[model samples]
Target: MTPNDTKPSAVTVRGLVKHYGETRALDGVDLEVREGTVMGVLGPNGAGKTTLVRILSTLLTPDAGHATVAGYDVVRQPRQLRRVIGLTGQYASVDEKLPGWENLYLIGRLLDLPRKEARARADELLERFSLTEAARRPARTYSGGMRRRLDLAASMIGRPAVLYLDEPTTGLDPRTRNEVWDEVKAMVGDGVTVLLTTQYMEEAEQLASELTVVDRGKVIANGAVEELKAKVGGRTLRVRPADPLQLRPLAGMLDELGITGLAATTVDTGTGSLLVPVLSDEQLTAAVGAVTARGITISSITTELPSLDEVFLSLTGHRASAPQDARPADSREEVAV
Candidate 1:
């Protein structure tokens, strides 16, 4: 189990609130990122994920609540907090006019490293991210993935204790995304704790052992990746009744079975079917037999493990509808204060 006793939170937040005008960008949010582990904050685009990252990175101050990174308060001890934390924002913040090597070197220098040490660190990271061949090329000449790697490498130049990655793989190709994932795994292995925010469901599942779902500027659900899935149900049993009229009754009957406790069965209005999430073969069998015993015919029946998309829908009462362009009011709360 990640975030187990063996590890304690390197970062902690309590009732962290931030507002952009009248909009509550973050509403009483609380979180924990265990030391040396990845805590994935998963939500739809414009779901206040970026705002949370900004506040944690000490770039923006919160309106209410408190946050600490490496035992330093974000508001009161921002300088110390900044020293122990790194941030890779949604878009690549690298200077396109500079080469990859220069970008990293500049960041290292800003961190107050000696000139030679900064140069060595920059080269080392270029090799680690497989950008050595293109290190001399300007950032604008680099590919999307390469620039992202450079941005990430720059964040790590100071060897910070905690890193905040806000949608780091948002626009990369699958291959490049996987490459970033490998680097993150390597960082965690080296005892660097990370707090990762992403809209991609697979990214959260693949990178973080612990996960939190943020929506409408609040933490809606949180647990281990498997724990959250299990909460929504690992396997969902889909049953389409031959008679639409039988849908509700069949759902009630299955719910009465208490195989998964109250509210376990949901009626899928679109297809007039009952979706009963089951944990075992026996529970699936019981629900099916109960429907048939009641003279209700099942038009189609199947069982499938719940996808993260489904989990998001179930928790938020809506599909994880992400916008491609500038976000609506809720998610684009990263206003400078």
Candidate 2:
């Protein structure tokens, strides 16, 4: 969408809830996405990330609460919301029998674009996604990465103002994943608001201006990358010894500095290493000085911030492992709107 066409607050949700029998899929989840910015939704498996996306995209209704996408109520104005939103799920949804260009063209036509406009859009997306060289090939012949790009292109056919990408880069190589990230950046530059769901910490850090961490169907933490990391704790000092014989002295130094729970191991199989967690920068410097004074040669000393995985584990009681590849094939029962 063009910059002039973009509106602020493309998505807003409050107290959204969905249930499956006795299980609460979404427990009063609240989310907001600003216009022309990427908002990343992060969570571990069974955390209701997909359900929130589905509700906002108009695929599923909520048991309680309200949501609006692109200024239209998702429940009351489902058709209007659907028209302005594009959803690309964890799996590619392209028709294997259709050629790459044809798949995009078909979606354009489905969105009521004229034949000429549809064809032009198809070609434009084909070139934009670097699929022009293989545009005429059936989707079945395309690689996993190619199929994913085509699927993403299909969703953009109508120039959606709000896009929902649910784990869009799963199962792709690093190169292809970077390509997708580039496209997402381009979309934001062009003023399309995005809601991206993923378990990849780096992905969220790279693209999202704001992030929400969900656990057990509730938002446990939400903020910018640095802010979330700060919530987990401060920096950690890491030290690796030059000699295995220095481990004992290192432990004593760490103990003298009041840095307890110092763990030692051979990280490089041959090189001795000791990892200890200190509370502050002053403690880090004191520990290092004490070890060096004891004639211990320090191979490496560095300060490490808590990763997103560490933040998630600290906030939620579980680590953000890679999501499973399984997608429910059967349609789930609809809950109340």
Candidate 3:
């Protein structure tokens, strides 16, 4: 059985609070991460996600409440806590001039590994991250995805039990993002507990076993992705008409079907699509028949669960904006790790 197969909690927090002057960065935040699983902290920019991470990682002190990582108190055993946790932030921290192997080797030395052992560990990590071919090349010569893998490798030099990844793939291309996702999945397969902070719902859905949504310094919601989606308005039926002008006609047909509680929202002219909030599988079946009866062609039609974006809006009364690296109002200077 894997570490996640066990019942122990890897990280725990309760009634956490933090403030910078008048602004509250975190307030009564609470969460628990299962061992060897990924717990995603999902939120928009300026939602205290980073503040909570800083406190949990022992880089910053909370004003109140308690937190523990790897069974050690975050406040009282910070040094020991740091030893058991590794962190990778929004940007890569690798030195541009250093080769990939050197970066990992340097971190191992910093963690007090003997020279020969550090070198061996570096070689092992390079092979594990699939960077052995590029191991000797300057980090500046590597692509964005390779650089990110190198950064992740550096964080693992000390073999931390819990890893903290804060927006680890924020600016990468889709392919690169997937590459990093694969790496993260591989890490979890090796029993590394992860706490990933991200603003993108897709990222949370892709990697997290459980998620906690924070907004304006407080946790607005928490659950598995499916559970959280159910808390929103439930799944929706989305249709993309084959012909742009058919959108209106399709909506009219759907409304005219006399199906109870089936009201199609206005068509989005730009995308030639219409979204209908669905309360049951019966409504989806009725919708399909209605469109077919009208002889209207649709390029694509599907019922999808409420996305993380909708969940955020429903819980917080606002939609998530574009992804950014902005921090909460109470954010102060970076606390050294």
TM-score of each: 0.79, 0.83, 0.82
Q: What is the lDDT of candidate 2?
A: 0.81
Candidate 3 structure quality by residue, lDDT tens digits, 1-337: 4344466899999999999787788888999999989999877667888888889888899999999999999999998888888999878899989999888988999899999999999999999989999999999999878888999998888888999999888777778888889989998998999999987777888999888988878998988888888877566788898898888877776776788887656677877788887787788788777776677777988777877888878887777654443435244225321
Tell me, by lDDT, which candidate is best.
3
In order, the Cα lDDT scores of the candidates are 0.83, 0.81, 0.84
| Candidate structures ordered by lDDT, highest first | 3, 1, 2
**TM-score (C-alpha) between model 1 and the true structure:** 0.79
Candidate 3: regions farther than 4 A off? 1-6, 238-251, 257-261, 265-275, 280-302, 321-337
Clashing pairs in 1: 46-331
Clashes of each: 1, 0, 0
Question: CA lDDT of 194 in candidate 1?
Answer: 90
lDDT, model 3: 0.84
Residue 109 in candidate 1, Cα distance off native in Å:
0.8
- Candidate 1 or 2, higher lDDT? 1
